[model samples]
Each structure stands twice: as C-alpha cells, then as structure tokens.
Target: QQQVKQSPQSLIVQKGGISIINCAYENTAFDYFPWYQQFPGKGPALLIAIRPDVSEKKEGRFTISFNKSAKQFSLHIMDSQPGDSATYFCAASMRGGNTPLVFGKGTRLSVIA
Candidate 1:
C-alpha cells in the first residue's frame, strides 16, 4: 500500500496563477514533511518542508501546509510561472531517524505563458 497519497495526477495552469498539490500520509509517526521538485533530466531538489510542530511554512513562492491531526499536507505555488512547471512530490519521514523518506505519487504541473 502507498504510504502517501497525492491528487491531480497532472495539472495545467495559466501564468501568474496558483498551483496546488495535496498529499496525505498513513504513518502517524511521520513528523518531518518535505516537498521535492524535479525537472526532467535532473535530480529532485528540496523545495520546502515542515514539521508537525508547525502548521505552515513558506519560502518564496513555495509553501507547505501541514495538518498533523488530519495526517495530511499540501504544496502551494504562488504566482505560478512557466519556470515553476515540474513534478512535485510530497514526502514524510520520522524525526531524528535514519529512515528514508516516503514520497507521494508526484503531481505534474505545467504553466503556460
């Protein structure tokens, strides 16, 4: 079974719009949540992250909203641009452990100029 669930297998957005991606985790022990963005032919890079202790976190145009009680999380892209088009994955892992992160089925976003 997939540990994390994501929606909107694919998405297309106009320039300067908002792009949203959502995810949910099955493991309550997961305290660390991270979002990764990947471009074709390149490794995924960390975009933003949050912990159960926080409700939300934002870095520039990228934002992460975490809900511990709901066991869910989401990524929001503000002022979506063509350059922001990429595959985004929501991941979760336990805090203070060597365990690998569990990633959601990625959401593919395309921004039209």
Candidate 2:
C-alpha cells in the first residue's frame, strides 16, 4: 500500500477560473500529505500540505482537502491564472521521518489567457 494515483494527466482552465485535481492513496500508514507544484525545468515546491489529523488546509489561493477514511485528497486553486500553470503532483509520506514520498504521475495544468 504505497501508491498514490492522480488523474487528468492534463487540465486546461481559463484565467480567473478554478482548477481542481484529485489523488488517491492506498497506504494507511502514511500520515503526511503534500501537494507540489513544479514549473518547467524546475524542482517541485511544496504548495500546500495536510496531515491526517486535519481534514483540510488552505494557504492563500491554494487549498487541500483530505479524507482519511477514503484515503484520498484533492487540490483546489481559486482564481487560476496563466502564471499558475504548472505540473502538480500529490504525494504522501510518514511524518517527521525520512521516508521517501510517493508521487502521482503528475497533472499538467494550463491556464489560458
């Protein structure tokens, strides 16, 4: 149970619109959930994260909704923009530990002008 799967290999949204991506995991042992955003030729950066202890987390325009019982999570972007276009990856891992994160195949988000 060490897999995280994401859908919509690509997404197209208009500027000032909302963008959503979903992810599912199979490992119950995983306690840390993080969504990363990556631009072209750059490493992914932690956009937002949520732990099993919390049902949801939000930072600015980014929000992460988590469901422990369902072992799933999703990222929501409010007011999406062309500048916000990037590859998003949902990941899971153990908390306060060095366990490698399991990443989704990735969803390429494009915001049209």
Candidate 3:
C-alpha cells in the first residue's frame, strides 16, 4: 500500500524561481516528515524536515511546509539554481516505530539558467 503520494513526476524551473513539490499521506500514525534530495549517482540526503507539531520549517533556501490536519506537506525551493537540480523524495515515518521511512516516487527537478 502506497502510504504517501507525490505529484509532478518532473519539474522545470528557471533560475531564481521557486520549485514546489507536493505530497500527501493517509496514515495518521505518521509523526515524522522529511524531504530528501538526491543527485545523480548519489544516495539521497536529508534536506529538511518537519514534525506534526510545526506548520513549517526553513533551512537556508529550502523550506518544508506541512499541514498535519490535512495530512499533506510540500517542499519549496527558493531562488532555484542549476546546482539545485536533483531528484527530490518526500518521506514519512512514525517516530520510534523502528519502521523504515516510506518514500514517494520522486520528482526530477531541472533548474535552467
């Protein structure tokens, strides 16, 4: 069962613009939400994350806006640059559940100059 759903399999954004990727989950048990950024031939790395207790979390140019009641969340990349182009995956896990994170299919983002 796919617990998380992500939209826009691919995205193209011009430099200095914003790139948004959305995701939704039905499992209310999820308490931890994280977004991972993966470059070509490299493993996914933790980008930013948010818990149900907060509505948003920002780290530098990356921000995660979450809606706990709606069971949805999104990643917003500000001032998108070509170097930022990568495959982004949204994931969810229950804290201390000992269960691996459930990931979305992924969105390939291409930022043009």
Candidate 4:
C-alpha cells in the first residue's frame, strides 16, 4: 500500500476559488510534511511545509493544515488562478536534511478562467 494516500486525483476550480488537496500517512515516525507544486515540464518545487509540532502553516496564498494525531495534512490555495493550475503533491519524510520524501500519488488541479 502507498505510504501516503492522496484524494481526488484531479480537480477543476474557477479562478479566484479555493483549491484543496488532502493527504494521509500511516507512518508516525514521519516528522516532515510538505506540499509540492509542479508545472508542466518542470521539476516539483516546494510550496509549503509543516512539522508535527505545527498545527498549521501559511505562505502567501498557500496554506498547510496538519493533524498530528490523525496523521493527515491538507493544502489550501486561496484565490486559485489560471497560473496556479498544476500538479500538487503531499510528501512525508523523516528528520533528515538530505533524505528523500515519500510522496503521495499527486493531485492535478486545474484553475479555469
């Protein structure tokens, strides 16, 4: 089974709407939870991240809500835009700066104008 389960393989939202992506992990040892955004023909870029101690984190129009007890995390994009349409991924990793992350299947979001 996948380490991280992501919901809604794809999504379509009108411009200025909110885009939400959810993920759940089965491993409690995972301490780093991050969300990545990727545009076509480019590598995934780190959008936002949260640790187990943090319940929520926000950067610009992006936000991450984490539930340590539930081992789940979600990403919300405020005011979705056409330029924001891309593939979003949720990832989990141990407490290592040079470690690779176990990523979710990914959610493709399309912001329609």
Candidate 5:
C-alpha cells in the first residue's frame, strides 16, 4: 500500500483534554512512520514516530502508537492546550532511494481555551 488515510478532517477539544486521531496505510514497503504537526501557513514538523519494530513512541505531550499487523497508527495529544491547536498529519516513507514521504489528508485540531 502507498497511501495513508486519516480521519475526522477536524477535531475540537477542551484545554487540558486529550485529542486522538487515527490513520491507516496500505503499503507494506513503508518502513518509516512519522507524525507531523503543522500550523496555519507553516510547514509540517515531525511530532513523533515509531517503526514497525516498535509498538509505540512518545515525545512530551505527544504519543504515537503504531500497529504493524493492522497497518495502522494513531496520534494522541495529552494535556491539550490552545497552543497545541494545529493541523496534524500522519506520514510514511521508506528509507534509502527516492521514496518521498506520503501524508494523510490531515486533521485539524483545535483546543478551546
């Protein structure tokens, strides 16, 4: 599979709450998993990621739980804050060669004050 699909085009959560988003991929050739956070008019920045060898990875308030068997992954934002409000994307890529990263359509997250 060469595509990663994300859901809930948008999300709204209260400050200090948890926000969750899911994604699925079809390509088994993909070896790298990365989640990116993007603000309006800015480039996406890597948030967290996990390879097929690992079940999960976390960075501060962000966590990425991956399922290799299911070909799925999710991003969990803990202690959501207004500053965390932004568009999140789940992406996949194979190392080496010219395999460009493939991204999901994106999920817009808004944390209300």
Candidate 6:
C-alpha cells in the first residue's frame, strides 16, 4: 500500500526554470518529512527536509515547503539545471513509530538545455 502519493510522475523543465514535485500523506503520525534525490545508479541522498513544526526549509537550490494541517509537502528546485535531472522520492517517518520510512512513488525530473 502506498502511504504517500506523489504527482506528475514525470516532469520536464528547461534549464534555469523552476521544477516542483508534490506529495501528500495520510498518516498524521508522520512527523519527519524528507525529500531524497537519486541519480542514475546512485543511492538517494537527502536533498532537503522540513518538520511539521516548521513551514519551510531551504538548502542551496533545494527547498521544501510543508503544510502540516494539509498533510502535504513539496520540493522546489530553483534554477534547475541539466545536472539536476534525477528521480526524487518524498518520504516520511514517525519519530517514535517502529515503521520504516514510507516513500511516495518517485518523480522523474528531466532538465533540458
């Protein structure tokens, strides 16, 4: 069962444009939200993250905006570049729960010149 749902299974963005991916979760117990970026043949890396207590967080060109009441969150890639192309997965995990991290079905992003 998919606990998290992600939209725009695939996205194409021009270089220097903004690329956005969104996800929604049904589990309120999820307190930690993280966005992971995975390049071909590589493991997913922590791109950026935000907790329910915070509304947003930014790191370099990556940013995560979260809405606790809405049980939704999004990742925004500013000034997207061709090198930024990858498969992104939004995940959540309850700090106290024994469950492993739950992830959305991954979004494939391609940035063109």
Where in model 5 is the C-alpha error above 4 Å?
none
lDDT tens digits by residue: candidate 3, 1-113 = 44899988999999999999999999888898899999999999999989899999999999999998888999999999999999999999986866799999999999999
User: Between the candidate structures 2 and 4, which one is better when assessed by TM-score?
Assistant: 2
Scanning candidate 1 in windows of ten residues, the lowest lDDT window is 90-99
For residues 1-113, write the lDDT of model 5, one tens digit per residue: 68799987999999999999999999888888889999989999988878889988888988889899999899999999999999999999986846799999999999998
Clashing pairs in 4: none
Worst 10 residues of 6 by lDDT: 93-102
lDDT at residue 90 of model 2 (Cα atoms)? 96
Error of 4 at 48 (Å): 0.7
- Model 2 C-alpha RMSD to native: 0.9
* Per-model TM values vs. the true structure: 0.95, 0.96, 0.96, 0.95, 0.94, 0.94
Q: Is candidate 1 or candidate 5 better by lDDT?
A: 5
Please give the clash total of every predicted structure, in order: 0, 0, 0, 0, 2, 0
Q: Show where candidate 6 strays beyond 4 Å.
A: 97-99
- Tens-digit lDDT string for candidate 1 (40-65): 99998999889899999999988888
For model 6, residues 88-108, the per-residue Cα lDDT tens digits are 999999877565788999999
**Which 10 consecutive positions of candidate 2 have the poorest summed lDDT?**
93-102
Clashes of 4: 0
Worst 10 residues of 4 by lDDT: 92-101
- Please list all clashing residue pairs in model 5, or write none if there are none: 1-26, 1-27
lDDT of 6 at 21: 97
Candidate 5's TM-score reads 0.94
Span of 10 residues, lowest total lDDT, candidate 5: 91-100
